[model samples]
Structures are given as structure tokens and as C-alpha cells.
Target: MNVDGALAPAVESILRTARERTPGEDAERISVDARSFSDALADAEENGRVPLIAEVKPTSPTTNGERTDDPVELAETMVENGATALSVLTEPEHFGGSTENLRRIREAVDVPVLRKDFIVREEQLDAVAADLVLLIVRFVDDLEGLLSAAEERGFQVLVEVHDEEELREALDAGATIIGVNNRDLARLEVDLGTFESVAPVVPEDTTLVAESGITTTADVERMCDAGADALLVGSAIMDGDVGENTRRLVNA
Candidate 1:
């Protein structure tokens, strides 16, 4: 509940935005006929390929400049190169993201869109047009309630965890899809071992996604060997050739 570390600023900024929203704004929601995000990852695994969830992040707290000016174009290129899903940052200010970009990317691609943001309350889920949403267990008090709320809104929740305790909380909350973030919010440092350490404890039935610190094909191979069903790559793909970099990871 006491937000701190690398996520403190983002969590603070997102809460203000969540508070400003008028409740029930999505009462007459225009539903998106979303593709199943979990199924997409599972299908990739079943077909003997590690799934990829390429991100559409323009900027981040850790980066200095904008990664791309046109998110839709970048998203299309990623999918063309075999990305299974897309994660779009929706938190502005620190992340240089917006809901407009999420909507635009979702329209440009048929793959499922993940609204990657610091979601602390159910109110934030209102008006989210994406097929999936992210919920960090460290920032949430009632993980179960928020998970239920997201599912009720017709969005699959990718419960994020940084370590063992948070992973336990996610499992207790009945999370089916889990993303192990290698970047520690406390120090903004990434250690690939974080996923490797947590992966074995996660139930085989749960879809596990390895996030952060993955850039090269070797890194992708390492994660797959460690039991990652999918990889959520951001800075690595955005900082260079989008299509080429994505292809390298996809073929890895």
C-alpha cells in the first residue's frame, strides 16, 4: 500500500488519474471482441514456440528518450515479425503513454492488447478497451478483489510479481497468468535470475511470462529453459530495429 522504489512515482501518478475518473463512466461500455491472451500464449507453447508479448512503450522512467513516435506502426511491425500479443503502456507522465495509443494499437492489430499500467483500484478498469490489464501485487492490498474486478470487466489480468512473497500472493489470489518482472522496482535493476528463481514454484498450469532484461536471443532461450511460457519485452525491442529485433527473438 505504501508505494516506493521505481514504481512509487508511477503508482502515485496513476492513482491521481484513477481518482479523477467519474465512476460508472463505462456503464454503457462498448465491448471489444477481444482475443484470448492466455490462450494465445498457450497456443504458442503447444506449437513448440515461446510466445512473445512485444510492448508499445514510447518511454519509461528508466529511459531518457522516446522510443517511437508512432506506436501503431511499431506494433504492426512487431506482429509482422511473429509477436503473439502487444502490451501498451497507458500511464502518462513518467511512461509517456496514453489511452489513445492503446486504442489505436488495438484497432491496428488483431492480437490481444494489454493495457500496461499501475492499476490499484477497480475504477481504473473503467473505459479500458484492451483485452488484458496488469496488476502488481506489491501495489495492491486486496489482490483477489482486484483480480475479480478485472475479470468481471472482461479483461484478463496478468498478475505481476517481483519475488517469492509477491508470487505467493498472486497464487493465493488465484492468478492464472503470471508475469515475473526481473527489474526490481526497489532499485530499478534487472536480474534475469529473478524469473529463473520464481518459475519453478509457479504451477505448471499457470501461464508464466518472463518480463524485463531480455534483449538477445540467448536471453530468450534462457527464459524458455527456465519455464517461461511467454516473454514481455520492451526497451530492448523499442530501442533499436523493431522488426529485426522482434524477428530475432521470435525465431529464437
Candidate 2:
């Protein structure tokens, strides 16, 4: 499967899987009340630290294997330890995630949940019951239309962008929450500086989130210093003691 220069083979493969995948019966309904990811972040910021959106990623193309912790239990621990929200990977084959994981985690925790997937169509939104949904700029054909579709589904869109052009597209699409992804999907390489470079160009009113390659307290502080309202972390939390790691990053 070929893709644009900005998309890596791994990401391209995930999109292919997403295209072929269909929503289950449960996806046809919305089961829970949607929490406000924006409100959660705003409330956390008042506490004097950058808010954390810890991820419930069982596995990834870059990781060795799936997490041993139960998804719901891990999500509860994250919320208990101070995660402002949770990001759940729902792409099954490469990421080892499922909508069931999102549903269970959403039911178990009070914080807003983010359905992180390679969303390329509106049908994907039907399967998501999260408060927030990730829309990577490079994956979707019409960013504005998709954003509207997501809004119609009662979700706050977290538009993920890898570069300045994508960032402009997101802003033009009227995205209120934007995530600066440091990992270049084309090569699957992470560089924390990506956020630092893009942060200056984002509007002050936009709720900015820094994603990927963040692993330490220093990294968290670096992003906060660069004007990130929230930080989305996965491998750092899942690879260590979930509670301790969540506390450590949340406190940072």
C-alpha cells in the first residue's frame, strides 16, 4: 500500500486496516456521557502544572509486545494518579487495541477518553464513543468535512499535525484542540524538537497538545515551557509501574 511521502509504511498499513475494518454492533450506539477533554485540561492547568493525557496503548509498531495490565484497571489507575484524560488506541492489528478497550476504559474512568486511531472516514466515527477523537491531518482527505462529521457525532476533535502545513490545515478546519505529533509517521522516528519548532506558530487561543517522544520529567517540562496545555504519553507509562509513572508525569 503506497502513501504520501509524509506517511510511513507502518502508518499506511494501519490506514489500510482501518479502511477494511467495519464497526461492530456496539458502535451503532453511544453508551456513555461524553466528558469534556478541554474542560479537564483547563481545570488541570489551574493546578499549576501541564495536564497529562496518559495513553492506554497495549502495543505499537515500535514496541516489543503488548502490555500485561488489564486495560480498564490501567485506565482507572491513571485517572486515580492524576491523568486529566485517557487516550486509547483502537487499531487492533498493529496497536493491539480494540473499541471494547475504549468502552471498558471509558466506563471505568471519569476523565474524558480519546479514541486514537487512523481515522479516514465517517464510518469510523460511528464506532467511537469517546469524548475526543484523533484526526491525523495526513490521513484524512477533507479535514474540514471530517471535523464537522466528528462534531455532529458530539465529539471534540483533537487534530494531530506533524508539520506547519498540516497545522495550518487544522486551524483552517476550525479545530479547537490541536496536537503536535513529534513522531514523523513517514519514518516512524521521534524528535521532541518537532513540538518546540511548531509551538511558536500556533495561535494563543488554540488548546495545544504535545504528543509522542515524551518520556521524562525534563521532556514534560520542555513541552510545558513550549506552551503545551496537555501532554499525551504512552510508552513511558505502560513500560514501567503504571501508577508510579502516571504520578511522576502528572506531577511534572
> Top TM-score: which candidate number?
2
> TM-score per candidate, in order?
0.90, 0.94
Candidate 2 per-residue lDDT over residues 1-252, each given as its tens digit = 124576677777888788888786566744435788778987887876459999999999988878968999999998889999999999989999998999899888888999998888777788858999999888788889989988887888899998898899899989989999999888899999999999999999999999999999999999999999899999999997999999999888
Output the TM-score of candidate 1: 0.90
Query: What's the alpha carbon RMSD for model 2?
Result: 2.0
List, residue by residue over 1-252, the lDDT tens digit for candidate 1: 535445555545656675565425545543445689877876777766559999989988777789756999999999988899999998776688888899899989988889998777777776558898899887787899989978877888899998888889899899999999998776678999999999999998898999999988999999999998889999888988999888888889
On the 0 to 100 scale, the lDDT of residue 159 in model 1 is 95
lDDT of 2: 0.88
C-alpha lDDT of residue 242 in model 2: 96
